[model samples]
Target: MQGPHSPAPPVDVQPASWRDLSSIRELEKLCFGRDAWPWIDTLAALTFPQTVRLKAVSDEFVVGFIFGDQRRLKRTGWIASIGVHPDYRRRGIGRTLLVACEDLLGMPRVRLSLRGSNDAALRLYQQAGYVRIDTWKRYYRDGEDAIIMEKVR
Candidate 1:
């Protein structure tokens, strides 16, 4: 029986690399609007050492992507960014990608920062057992606050 964290049966999750730059860029723009990372930043995320990037594939399309920043010295992994294609949200892609990244990070704690008004993201993170531990004022480029949430093992 599939519990809450399972990916939709047909979804295939795999490690993502620089080859996915174009699709990842489109998805970032779709999910974050003005806050989407620039092409350079997106490229770096996929190629940077110590970063864990993954893509969710369905119907031969890259439907979701997630990447994390791992700090071995701090024993903490920051979920740098995550997004799902608009038509693919809430089908367990987000949660599954999150869990998969967390495992690959293999750190004692995982944290993520999200815009304060992102209700769907807040819900997903909360359901994944993250608790808000801090907030950064005017953290986003448009001046939206960033809610910092963390999950500790």
Candidate 2:
């Protein structure tokens, strides 16, 4: 058993497959709660073509996940979702997943939306070179505005 001060286990970021459905579903619930995607959506995201699905595995368990939707015509990759298990926060896992998704997406521009009240997420995105470009009023189920952030290479 690891003590509170013990360093976290090594985490590996890799492509996620349909077999990760259950893990991803649980992660969605843990991360998004009411905003979590339906099972069908999660499955589709895992199986759909032209989408990037990645998972961060630590000690053989999924600790984080990211989904990137590539829109060729729009010339932008949308970060459909990203979440790290609560216990894994502040360990650079989210940022690692974000960067991995961006690199694999190979798009000139990448975008994502988040609840405006998520200060930690905002800081992470900002530190990763994302800038707020727009706001969708009442975008979330609870009427929280969604802040749209974009990073351009």
Candidate 2 clashes between residue pairs 3 or more apart in a chain or in different chains: none
Off by over 4 Å in 1: 1-9
lDDT of 1 by residue, 15-102 (tens): 9999999999999999988889889999999999999999999877999999999999999999999999998887999999999999
Candidate 2 C-alpha lDDT tens digits along 16-38: 99999999999999998988999
Candidate 1 residue 134 Cα shift, in angstroms, is 0.3
lDDT of 2: 0.96
Give lDDT: candidate 2, residue 132: 97
lDDT of 1: 0.94
Q: Best candidate, TM-score-wise?
A: 2
